[model samples]
Target: MLQSFKCEACKSNNQPSVSNHKDNSHLPDCKDEISLNTIGVIKTMFLEKRAVPRQASEAARIISRIELNSRIFNNPEHSLEGLETFSHIWILYYFHRNQIHLKSKVAPPRLGGERVGVFSTRSPHRPCPIGLSLVQLDRIDNGTIYFYGTDMVDGTPVLDIKPYIPQYDVPRKIERQEFFSPREAPDGEENCESVKTASTSTSGNLVSNVTVPNWVTNCKYLSVTFNETAEQQLQELAVEKKSITEILRADPRSVYLRTKYGSQIYTFQLGENTVTCKFDDQNSIVNVLQVRKVVILGDIPVSDDE
Candidate 1:
């Protein structure tokens, strides 16, 4: 035998009541009861926190504080004792900023900057609003835990914490999919020679195979180009690309400067290697000219004179 229930929030008429038996007289209809205080709140020193990274792995040096409630602090020290050995720790917390219910689809910055399903992408808007992050554990003291490289905002409530075990988590071999590919360089000189020979036999033009830099590999945006000239222009603008990249990578509105183009303040969107600006005036159009004397961080083309 089963019981039928009606929700108080939606009213009895809106929701359907089902019982093991078809007879309505056998089961009485009632509303479902739920408890809201399942999780505890966390306190931190960062109150007016801004420009926080969207992912914890990106910001691996910035320090932040975390405080757990005293009621559930039993064996907290024992739980965190083995965490010092691991390089990274997984933080499971709630997204206090999200106000809407979880949707089936979400707009992800990756996936060619398109909307993906909630299950596929890590969006803040969800039924639980729970956020998970792999952050570096710097130190742990009493009820307060200090972490580095966190995307969580100040005063965010923490649900749980777990040490990241590379042996158990890392797969022995991963099959590449169309959306994601392995970043490691190819092995063996013989294999490389064979590839070069095949390429030479097909076309005379020697195609130089180069590995992509770490900075470019980690970039989320596809439109940006990290050439020398582009970097030089960014440097001339009195902005550091590393720092600017951090700001632009996350929510741009949080990091972008409010500048007066004409009369109104317009926010600029930055790419991995390019900085884009918009004018408030309707008549003005954005354009980019040739760049000169760009700072080259990695392997770049050189002239005969140099």
Candidate 2:
């Protein structure tokens, strides 16, 4: 059975904009309430609170699935019409983990602990805890969207999904990228086309496509060849070069840590294992030295560092 309804209580503008200006002042707090429906739930390998990536870019190889709510689960063939044409899709979801707190300002590590208005940054502690992410569309089968590049947690309530169209979405030219911070575009690097955000959450309240910085694409990545021990062990598990590329390219570190640590051992929690590597800034290579099983504390797999 197909069902639909019109909501006039809280009107939302879906058009893309530089800033989100939602006028909620008119509605009285005493009587105003807006309810949103959950269309699906996202299934991911990231189970721990800290295990998830800060943004979709870091989750390039992270395969996840979106299973539509059984209420709307019937007839995937009709519901997912014309969606296969696009290579990427936008996912709007609720940040279930961020419901505990809300704040107006936060210290963003990207700026070395500088305080900024919460609205200006992508911190999870905001007025609204909605999260938006762009991911590679693998294929939709039996009403499940199997995708890569997810930044959300397990059991996330998905509100909606939309295909990505580059023609209308990408702007021809920009007057100035003043909206971007200096840390995003360094002083002497070629004017980077895109920027990598260390955003923790979103306000589907205001959402858009995820764009990776051109610098990241152009950055030198040394050929990754495993040591004899690593190669022998990896063969048993059958890991691919493509998976390694996807994981390392998206710098997996806190904004504050990635900025100061020139040469250090960084570990990432992927699935049941912890990948430990040393990043060589001079040559711009990540040498994956070892992979070990993550220790379970409570119900989540934890890295030794944590």
Candidate 3:
């Protein structure tokens, strides 16, 4: 059943080997490739990858819609019969915009540009360009599912949708206490601590303690402010101040941009318009400057009046 070995061609024993896999009929016989098709296409205000939030929770105010493809289902409406009962759903989509390359390590924004294994962080540039997000289900109409809290860009190819059932999805807490050595802990985890003891539950259903890096648990949010001119522009455009504040609080900038272009004007597209702002590094605040229509005349961006 369980086995570990390397191919004959590999010279080093240090080469990656597959192990601990219990061979069974449930496992597919396919050797190299697996085929998948798009089930639907998602529409959202994030027109570009740079503008999309880093996490769904960061953009809780935004709503996105998934238009199911009829060709993928015999009767699309019938397929979604029992899904309306759930308040949340998991969306598995393809990261179509990511560049074709793999990196062993990545720098997470929260860590102040420290490198970590790619698997440790939710980077889109993985071996398989797939994304997963749990969003609050707003409503379901005929072949469309509208949900809030989206980090996906517009026109994303959705692979599947599954209802969020807590009992099935959430892992059971440990009914018994246990401690692990620092070597046993995950890579980012340093201190050895005791696992939480849970109330009496069914035997063999509980899981060991889960530990996350301190940086993940303690996130830093930037204070957002709007000038009189920016506030007036937002009012004129009928944009919610809270929506802009939520996005800016998350500080949606890559580490490279934040480091190199620290003093440059920060701009991101919101709907059909572009929002421009400045970061006050000394005060850790984001001061919104203005919102302008994204009209391009050659390389120059023109205002709505122009």
Candidate 4:
């Protein structure tokens, strides 16, 4: 005999319960595996997606061009014939600059120090680092499709392009999340009161002849002095932290105290700045000492003097 049950939510009594059902081994594997490289590569001028905006709506009026391969271009017109009617198109591309191994949890810049699940964040580190951008389509001529308001970095490879449909894509009402607040402008504008004119050189460098903003000029710990060994480790840490921290305590060779004289590795975490070096290895420290004025070249790691 078969058993019957009631629906808890609606209080209906027509539903059947499976508490006494016998198991049958007739189910097949449900994994659907698709082959990769099924689609051809899309060559574009964008290289890295980090420089791309977190959302496509943020970028407006930025022009970018997409070119398809000759094979795909043979019938490109047929594939994109009616695409121009749509105001916006969805661009799917690969993130070529993801360095860290794909992780399920990522530290988003907006979250400060908190670690959020990768699915909740728009992190590039995923099973496949694919990016989606809703770009404004300007025109399509031959195999080239010109777009505007693109956030993709120069030389980024595009994967696919699909026209955005308002009827299907637009949401009725979006529930707000805690971290969905708009970004605020920096508070340094108040300090710009004394600023007169800001000019840049032909080489694209800011040539500031006027006095710096009061916020920056009034900083007491602007200049940091460190020994060669300590300076090197600080440089390494600066690259990782992307911010400069003043060194408060001074103890030369403090980082190398753990190891014997020959194999000593010295490192120090000064505020947000971190420096690392090996005993007798002064190459990294020497480079940091040379740039005392500002924390320049923080991205590149230097070898310690050996």
Candidate 5:
């Protein structure tokens, strides 16, 4: 079950030899650069990389489907052996859109564009562009894996998959290594104090032994409503009324966008349609102004089978 409490601070396939990505400091004495290939590709609602949720948790209920490269991931019937036994799986993929370069320092949204070491944050601009995510395993059918809670953009290259064993993945007791505490702004409740940081400790880790502030694990989202035209269009499309709401409630803005343009009319790709959302930061209300089917060239224009 989803639990709520505070004190925060947190947070491919191909089957080919992945490039060894060293952090800001690359080992000059180590081997040369390596080559990595895509094991499979993924399909998500995000047609482009504009308003993607920074973390998978921000878009938990959004469904994403993954297909392996048949040329490499053969034996479809047996490929996902014993995968169904677990409730979650790890997705390893490449940042196909990442440029061919590396940066020692980056500005993270969480720190309001504060310059921090590339190794200190999850920025894609790294020595090697790779991604790892843990998603709830909805089910597996044929050679495809259907799951929820993905931050991947459409057509993401998935490299590998592995079952999640609690004993091996989940720690018995979590040490307070995180520097964040959740922000608690509730109905008739004001959010307590928060201290966002981009500094590392002398020991080469994030701020250790930091104070965790009271944060909100969940918030009541304003029930999204549509106009007459949008309502009729939504009914015709057979889209759930809650699907758009969930994304808004999760606050699609990255830490940078939120700090910069929280009141702007945020537009994002939703399936084959475009959704325009205007959020009221004070009351936590999201207004769905428009939902129109758009022509996205890279969009998968069709539904998946099996």
Candidate 6:
């Protein structure tokens, strides 16, 4: 059971004190318990946590499926009335595999391990441990939805689904801006404007102008290359090389691994095969070492006679 409380400071008109906020005694005891149920489960290529992309958009080439629970719906087919019209959908799912504690600040991989407010980055370690992803809708059959761009594990529980409407989702007043990254800044120069496009809103409740540090905008992606052995193996397995290239180019390694381990051998399960690769950090290249089929040790083979 999830428990929550109401704070008295929220009831007051004046701004609440931040210094003695936790030690205050005027707060009343109004405990509220909330419960949520899963509407469906998502099926993806990622079987483990090692190589799942940090964001669904990073894995745009990957396809996934969502199977709604039949027990929860009287008419599963009727429940999904007109979701196919939209090209994309939003998935709200629980971070069931997250074991880390809540953090006020986190270091995103793209930031090169620079610490920032947890809210600024899309880290899984949150107060609620709930995840949100926007994926392209391919098709729908009955209560099942086939989508592209999934970052979740194979059996992630989906809480809810919503169609993506551009008018409601996208903001107005988008333009290009220049900002120099900290690493690339010239000597004796504290700040410099570089390049990128952003949106600003003057009328609505949104911030007048959106601003971000140079590191956020100056992200560099690693180039992926397959060797002769890996290329032959991929052909033998009949795996699409483009899919593997897309996943590797995003550099799925966590900040901890990238910072501590540096260039090392990384292995991840891709479909029914295990992919092994070596990271060349200096050149920002990922060389595919080999691809092999995953073997399950315990299962006995069934024959036609049985």
Better of 2 and 5 by lDDT: 5
Ranking under TM-score, best-scoring first? 3, 6, 5, 2, 1, 4
> lDDT tens digits, residues 1-306, model 3?
225554543324344344533554433333466689999999998888875788898889888899999999977888898788778899999998887447888888888799899888888888778899999999999989999998999999999998775444566654335344124445334231222222233224544555678878898899999999899988888888888888988899888888888856888888778888999766789999998777878987666756
Candidate 4 local distance difference test against the native: 0.48
Per TM-score, the best of the predicted structures is 3
- TM-score, each model? 0.49, 0.62, 0.78, 0.44, 0.66, 0.76
Which is the winner by lDDT between candidate 1 and candidate 6?
6
- Model 6: per-residue Cα lDDT over 1-306, one tens digit each: 112332454535454444445765754443455589899899998988889988898889899999998878977767778778778899999989986557789888877777889888788988778899999999998889999997999999999999875434654443353243135435333221221121122235344455677777787788999999999988998988988888888898888998899899998987688888999999999999888877665674222123
| Residue 32 displacement in candidate 5 (angstroms) | 2.3
Task: Say what the RMSD of model 2 is.
Answer: 12.9
lDDT of 4 at 285: 26
Report the candidate with higher TM-score, 5 versus 6: 6
Please give the TM-score that candidate 4 achieves against the real structure. Answer: 0.44
Question: Better model by TM-score, 3 or 4?
Answer: 3
Most accurate candidate by lDDT: 3
Tens digits of per-residue lDDT for model 5, 1-306: 123321122111222121333352532323366676677799898878876766787778888988877887576647886777668899988878878447788876545566777877677767878888889998888888899887788999987887664433543333465436454345323221211111111223323443432222233444555667667767877776676776776666766667777777887777777777787767767777767776534734422210
Off by over 4 Å in 4: 1-33, 38-50, 173-306
* Preferred candidate (lDDT higher): 1 or 2: 2
> Which sections of candidate 5 miss by over 4 Å?
1-30, 174-232, 254-262, 281-284, 295-306
Model 1 quality (TM-score): 0.49
In order, the Cα lDDT scores of the candidates are 0.51, 0.65, 0.79, 0.48, 0.67, 0.79
